[model samples]
Target: MEPLAFSFDQPLFQLASLPITAGHLVAAAALLMALVAIAAGRRARSLRIDERDGQISALLAAQTELQGRIATMAEVFGARQAELNQTLSQRIDGMTHRIGASISEQTKATHENLRRLQERLAVIDSAQNNIQALAKDMAGLQNILSNKQTRGAFGQSRMEAIVADGLPISAYTFQATLPNGARPDCIIRMPNGQPPLVIDAKFPLESWNSMRDAPDADRRQQAAQAFRRDMEVHVRDIASKYLLPGETQETAFLFVPSESIFAEIHEHFEALVQKAHRQRIVIVSPSLLLLSIQVIQAILKDARMREQAHLIQGEVIRLMEDLSRLDERVRKLQGHFAMAQKDVDEILISSNKLTRRGARIETLEMEATAPPGPSEKGERAVDNRMGQLKLRVVDED
Candidate 1:
């Protein structure tokens, strides 16, 4: 049933599957699986390479940015740190120098304060010594004033000193005896045309001191009454003694214990004061003493002025007499001057007239001495070639 051309030499195996064998099939299948495995391995390797590259690039970029940022931070930090160090160093140095300067200044100030304190202490010591000296002087003064007469004398001296400071001593005088044969303490001249005034100093010391130092009330009362009586008596006595008829009146002065005493006199002893007034006795106290002194000073000044005027009256009269004589001499000299003026006028007139005569004579002499020409001599001469030309104009009527 087979084809007759088939040769017996062909292998039965070849004829059964010509190119395809079991081994071939297995080899092809193995080859194909090997290629797929190789391709997958290459692709995985490429993808891993690409991912590595991208991660590497991102890391590189981040590294570069970090480097730059680190550099900038380093620069800024270094600069700030340097500046902080500089500022701190300057502050430390300044503080140290200031400490040294302050110590020096404090030492100097302490020394100066010590010196000033020493000077103040010395001044205080000196002032204390001066104050002690003043205290001793005051004690001596108090002792001196304890005596009534001494106190009165002190007052008088003070008043006199004040007067001497402001005015001359010649302006004042004291202890003038009135016409009543009683000597007053002082007298003052009045201004213009007023009367003179007198002053008397009185002190009922024994009675007043008795009252002041009395230990018992009754004794004090008795002493006071006695002192009052004594004062009244003195008031009348002063009026009688100092108040003369023409020179002074009953309006004389009586000095009392104090301003308080004077005021008390006006209070409780109003009647006595009235009586004193009727007797023309004015009572003054220490407070009123200045006014009295001023009055007296004015009077003394006026009196001195009047006395000086009286003394200069003679000189004034002499001066006036000399002035009258001078006036008379001036009149005589004026008369002499008038006569000299008249003589000058007469001389001037005579000299003028003589001068006029002399001028007329000189004119006559000059006219005679003038040279005369031929025509003037009553003849005319002409040269041989020249003719004398005379022109006569007849008047036509």
Candidate 2:
């Protein structure tokens, strides 16, 4: 027997060529229904796959756009961050520089202030030392001024210094004995044969001090009165002792060494000054004495200039005579130079004539030695003219 073969299109078992039974029909139907179901299922699966692909494509496109946007945002953020960092750095640098400059300025100012403070401290220390020294000097002066004779000597010395500073040594004399046998502190000789001016340096300082240091008004008044009386007595004594008939000046000086005392007398005792003036005794401070000495020096200088006037005139006259002599000598020398120049001009003319004559003689000799020219007569005539020029040159010499 042959092997049985099964085919989907063919009947399972064919009875003859006629074939076909109900089973076959039913199998074929079942197979067709299965095929239809499979087709439907495939169609449904294809539709579902298409829908999912569309959804996936849409999601990918959206993701790609989102990625592009994110990239752009990141770039923008980076650029902004770089700019912000640069800006921040610049601001930080600026702030740091400003802070450094401010700190430096403050430090310099602090140092300067400290230096100035140190200088001020040094100045204060120096000032304090000077004040201490001045206090010691004041104490010494007070001690010296306590004694009357020493005070008088001090006044005399001060007056002498002023007088010596203002006037020449010959113009003034110190401790000079007057014609009346009274020795004054200084004597200033007046010019033009005027009487000698006497200066007395002693003054009533005790009463003035008492008046200045009185306790109350009554005491001060009494002290002022005593000071006035003492000054009046001094003025009277100076006038009587120093003022001579023809030897001393009518106005004598009572020198007050202390400017303060002099000022006090002028301010508070005008009447006393007037009284002294009436007695021909003028009150003078050290400064006033210096001024008076200067005036006297001026007068003496004027007198000296007057005395030397004739000598100056004589010297000027001698200078004029000398100038006149120098002018005369200069004129005579100029005349001699003119005569010498004329002689030199004449010698130059003679030398020129001699040079011309010698040149002619040389030309004649050259012509005579040459072969006789076409005109020997002309050559002989040239020689004769050269001889004549030589004779004229000798005559000029």
Candidate 3:
């Protein structure tokens, strides 16, 4: 009655109440193969993901360790840098201080050297001024020495100065007139009523100058002969004028102003010196005259000492008498001091006893109640103790 239905899935058999077909079996087998392929792919993907995760963790750990090491190295380097900076600063400061000190020392040394140089320059300047003054004096002296009368005056003046310096005003007289109306340059009064010693400062130096100025040996010889004759004549004159037996010393001094001239005469003219000495005329240079003055002064001093010998002896006797009286008075004073010392010792003993009694009284306590009455024997013992306590002062004088 119905139209026949053509179908691709035809039921081959019925199992229980379900119809089974070939198309259904084929679809089930294809689905199972697809599920197996999908499961295997998922397992391989999970294994790859686990391996990548392990590698990432290892890299992160390594990076963290490297960062820690870098931080530690940075800290060490910073500390080293700080130490280096401090060392450099200290060295720089030390160098700066040393350099400053060196500069300061150098400045002080320079100033000291400059001061020394200035002092030396000042001394040189003073020396230059003194040299100028000395040159002027030399010129003046040459002018004075050129004239005969001025030269004689100069010699006399120099001799006067020497005598005045050596002898007292009362001991010597300048331009003293003798009994024979002969005037001498100086006269030194001798002690003990002896005749005064005479000094003559006049000397003839013209022939000496001529001899020194001679151009030839013959002229020099002639000038030297004249000089000798002049010297002999001057010596004779001095002897006749100054060597008066009753008025002046038997020996008279002929003063030569120039030491060089005196030396020259002594060296070249031995005969003249002997002649002068024989005639009681002693040729003396300034130094020799000074020595003679010293000798005369010593003689005068000895004579004065001899004259006062009696007075000195009398004074010594008086001093000895005074010293004996002083010794006797000192002995009496010592006896008096011994008595005073004994009195002082006794006073000290009384003071010590009073001090001990005062201490004993201070230690005793005051009581309001009266002490018990004493027996007759106890009263006698108390009286003896009180008598022992009484102070006795001794007088030594």
Candidate 4:
């Protein structure tokens, strides 16, 4: 085969019936080359388009997976948020309950404390009022005791109260006149024919009070001497006036009416006490007077009881004799009742026998009246007459 030649300057087709030159052939060849290049470029463009489509498919698949993951994450987040909300709500409710209970307890305790405080305050106010009333009473008592006459009256009243409380009205007499035309403050009558006891209530308190209230030792000594002289004089007067041989007891009581005065006398005036004792005079304070009065009352009671003892014994003996006689009479009466019962029983027995005889007589008479043989009729009549005779005998008995 001949060598195949390639023509670079040849036209592949005629355009318009004109012979194309080499330059034209060259241009056509260039054009043809350009066309071939353009076709290749178009193929490359198709390849690039296919590659882009594949990348876009892969991206779409990735996007779909990412979307599914986001949806799952959102669901989980929603569930977790709901759980946290519920937990928080539960904790808040518990805290509210605890706080409410605590507040209620605290309020109750506070109210209790307030009530106790109010009660204490009321008690304190009552105590304050009592203290004030006591102070007023003390002031009144001080005023009453300031004057000599009122103080004497107060002491006398106290003595009277003690006497009235302890002794019966008939046992004591106030302001009794003695046989010597001297009047004693009080006289206590003794039972069992004993002599009466005299009590003098007037006392010399001025000197004693002066001695107690003296400003100096010298003044106190002077006041004490005066007190002793005044007490001795009073005691002598009481011993002379109240101690009547037949009318009053040998010992007379000089009532001081004040315990303080009595204590002072005993503490400072021993010689005066001895003098009064020699004169058969007893110096007594209010408490000592009360005790002496009680002793006298007891003695009086015992004496009265002793005086009545014989009469009581006589009465008891008579009562015992009467009880013995009553017992004997009751025994005699019981014996008489027994005898009467026996007689009544005997009479009832006789009455029963009479009734039986009368019933037999009635039966015999009825039989006699009935039709019978002559002998039988004679026997029945005889039995009826015999039964009548027995009933008459029983009636006599």
| lDDT: the better of candidates 2 and 3 | 2
lDDT of 4: 0.83
lDDT of 3 by residue, 266-334 (tens): 999998899999998899999999999899889989999999999999999999999999999999999
**Model 4 lowest lDDT segment of ten:** 364-373
TM-score ranking from best candidate downward: 3, 2, 4, 1
lDDT of each: 0.71, 0.88, 0.87, 0.83
Q: Using Cα atoms with residue i matched to residue i, what is each candidate's TM-score against the true structure?
A: 0.43, 0.64, 0.67, 0.52
- Alpha carbon lDDT of residue 283, candidate 4? 86
lDDT of 2 by residue, 1-397 (tens): 9999666566555667867756677887999999999999899989888988988898899999999999999999999999999999999999999999999999999999999999999999999999999999899888878888888888899999999898888888999998789999999988888888999989888887788889999999999999988988888889889999899889999999888888978998999999999998889998888888888888888999999999999999999999999999999999999999999999999999889878867875676455556887979876786687668667856
* Candidate 1 lDDT tens digits, 1-397: 9877644344435445574555665676899999999999899989988998998999999999999999999999999999999999999999989998999999999999999999999999999999999999889877755787886665456544544454455544467777778876656555555656665656565676687789999998898789779878988788777877777643766655456656866776687778888888877775566676676677667767887996789889999999999999999999999999999999999898778756755664554343445573332322211221111111210
The candidate scoring highest on TM-score is: 3
What would you estimate as the lDDT of candidate 3?
0.87
Over 4 Å off, model 2: 1-70, 85-133, 329-397
Which pairs clash (backbone N, Cα, C closer than 3 Å) in model 4?
Answer: none
Off by over 4 Å in 4: 1-141, 318-397
lDDT, candidate 4, 160-198, per-residue tens: 777778889998888789999998888888887788888
Provide backbone clash counts, one per model. 1, 0, 0, 0
Cα-based RMSD of candidate 4: 13.1
